[model samples]
Target: MEINFKGKRALVTGASKGIGRDLVIQLVKCGAEVVAVARSRELLENLKKEVPSIEIVPLDISDWKKTKEALNKQGPIDLLVNNAGLAILGPLTEVSEENVDELFSINVKSIINISQWMAKQLISRKAPGSIVNVSSQASMAGLENHSVYCATKGAVDAFTRAACTELGPHGIRINAVNPTVIMTAMGKIGWSDPKVAAPMMAKIPLKRFGEVHEVVDAILYLLSDKASMINGVCLPIDGGFTAT
Candidate 1:
């Protein structure tokens, strides 16, 4: 089905690269006015070069005050993608406090702050809107060395459900997309070693990492009218890994 988002306004975080970048492109292609947020000014500029219609907002989501101010100025967002996250791979005991703080700040806290801002705007206007938080399959099941990462995503999954319940009456739908290992530049850099990739692949029923487009497609579905009845849901795109 052709999902048309003509005249809709979308704010996508972490839009500099990976699945977030593809989301911005696809949203723009569907005729939505997309405000792409990222910390990399040069990459944002390049993305704007490629898709001149996309509005580039270069700000770190971890800066809650700045993010709130920016969203207030933008006003009446139709869709919000809380896609900004950080991954620190290590045992919980081995992980530094700094890394743990960064993970929660970016992945968990930022989502709450941004969604609160967006929720207020939507509630005040009574506007119909949707929120898609990019979580992970790790949230569904724990791994050997992903305790901190799993904790952060577990927060995301919980937040999505609770937020949906609170925001649903205001005509806002909140949901999350939980993806397994995706083949992105960051993934390549982090899991390039077979030692890391081998055990991960073995758990997947499909025995392969998901592509960027697969996750983007899921995000677009949840944001569009097609998923009008779908809310407070965590849809897993995990290549059947979570099934077991």
Candidate 2:
């Protein structure tokens, strides 16, 4: 189905690269005004050079106070994508306290903060909106060395379900897309070795990692009116890996 976002205003975090960057470009192409947020000002500027119409917000969403202030200043947002995240991989027994804190700050806490802000904005305006939180397969199935990452995304899915009960009353929808290893710059680095990637690939029925656009298409659909009735779902874009 062709998804359209014309006349919509969207807020997308992690807009500097991977799935978030592509989402911004696609949203603009579909005639939505987009506010792109990321910590790397230089990368955001580069993205702006490519998509001149996008508005970039160079701030770390982990800082709850500043993130709230920045988001409050934006105009009415019809859609929100909580896409900013960090992954600190290590054996569970070897995980550091600092790493856990950093992971939760960005992956879990930032999402809650941003989602609350978006929900309140939509609520006060008496507007109906959609929120798509970018999550991961790690949340469902245990992956070696992904203990902290899994914990964060698991929190996101739980929050999505719980928040939907509150947001639904106001005609707002919230959902999450848990994607498998998409072949972005980071994904390539993480699974570059055939030995490392083979085991995971074997688990997927498709026998391959996902592409960035594949995940982007799913997010855009969830964000668009096409998914108006779809709420509080942790949809998997994992090539049936989780199903297995």
Candidate 3:
């Protein structure tokens, strides 16, 4: 199905690279005015060059005070994609307080903060809106050395549900997308070794990692009016990995 976002406005965090960057481009192609947020002004500037009409908001979404101010300045947004996250992998035995704090600050705290900001805007305006939080399969499955990352994503999924409960009454829908390893730069490097990838690959019915567009397609559908009835669902785009 062809989904359109004409006359809508979207705010996508982590818009500098990987799935976030591509999502920004696709949202624009679907005719939505977009505000792309990321830490790297230089990279965001380059993205602006490619998609000239998109507005860029350069900030670290983990900064609670500044994030609120930055998002408030955006006026009104019709769609929100809380795609910014950090993954610091380590075993439970090796995890440190600093690592845990940083991961939760970026991955969990940022999502809650931004989603609240977006929901308020939509609620105050009495506008119906959609929010897609970019969570991960790690939230549901246990990986060998991703204890902290998994914890953060788990929190994200729980928060998505809770937020939906409150926001649904305000005509705001909130959901999450948990994707398997996609072939982004980070995915290619982390899973490059056959030994590392084989165990995970064996579990997937499709026996392959996901591509960027596959996840993006799922997200776009959730963000559009096509998924109006879908709320508080943590949809997995894991090539049937979760199924196995």
Candidate 4:
């Protein structure tokens, strides 16, 4: 079935750049009213310049209280894309406690807070909606220097499943899209040197890095009516990286 988001209101976190930006553009293109959230006002402004139809909300997801207040002011959101996250790469032994806490707070806890808020609002209104958490393939396997990041995404995967079970009866579906490294600005920074890129590319059967639209396409499908029966599962858009 052809996917369309006409009459839907979507809120996308981390929408200033990378996969989040692509998602906002795609959602708007498909006729959805989008509220784009990001911490960077400059980047958000630039995004609006590119796509004037987007409604920009500049706020950090790490600030739970402020995020909740901001979201409460927005009325009802039909789709919540919890895509804000960070990766502070380092061996577990060397990673500071503060960094570990930040990783969990931003990557895991914020998702729960936002999803909970959105789910409650939608359920109270008896609105049918979707929640898509942007997780990582790192949640599926361990990697050197990625222990804490992995743990946070693992929590996200589990939370998505558990949240779906509770919210499904209320007509609110929750799912996650776990992707391997995509060629975004953050990905470029991580793979700037051939030494880093070679090993990463070798692992993927696709042999090349993923494109932003590829990930956004999967997200769009999950958010659309096309995935009406799909819920509580993490779909890996990793180009077979997790398979091998």
For candidate 4, the 10 contiguous residues with the lowest summed lDDT are: 1-10
Each model's lDDT: 0.93, 0.94, 0.94, 0.92
- TM-score winner between candidates 1 and 2: 2
- Model 4 scores a TM of 0.97
Candidate 4, 1-244: lDDT as tens digits: 5678888899999999999999999898899999999999999999999999889999989988999999999987999999999999987789999998899989998999999999899988999999999999999988889999999999999999999989999989899999988889878887789998889889989888888888999999999888999999999888898999
Residue 195 local lDDT, model 3: 100
Against the true structure, candidate 1 has what lDDT? 0.93
Model 3 scores worst on lDDT over the 10 consecutive residues at: 235-244
- lDDT, model 4, position 207: 88
- Over all chains combined, what TM-score does candidate 2 have? 0.98
lDDT of 2 at 53: 91
Candidate 2 residue 111 C-alpha distance from true site, Å: 0.6
In model 3, the runs with Cα more than 4 Å from the true position are none
lDDT string, candidate 1, 25-136, tens digits = 9999998999999999999999999999988889988988898888777856899999998988887779999998999999999999999988988888879999999999
Relative to the true structure, candidate 1 has a C-alpha RMSD (angstroms) of 1.1
**Count of residue pairs whose backbone atoms collide, per candidate:** 0, 0, 0, 0
Deviation of model 3 at 244, angstroms: 1.8
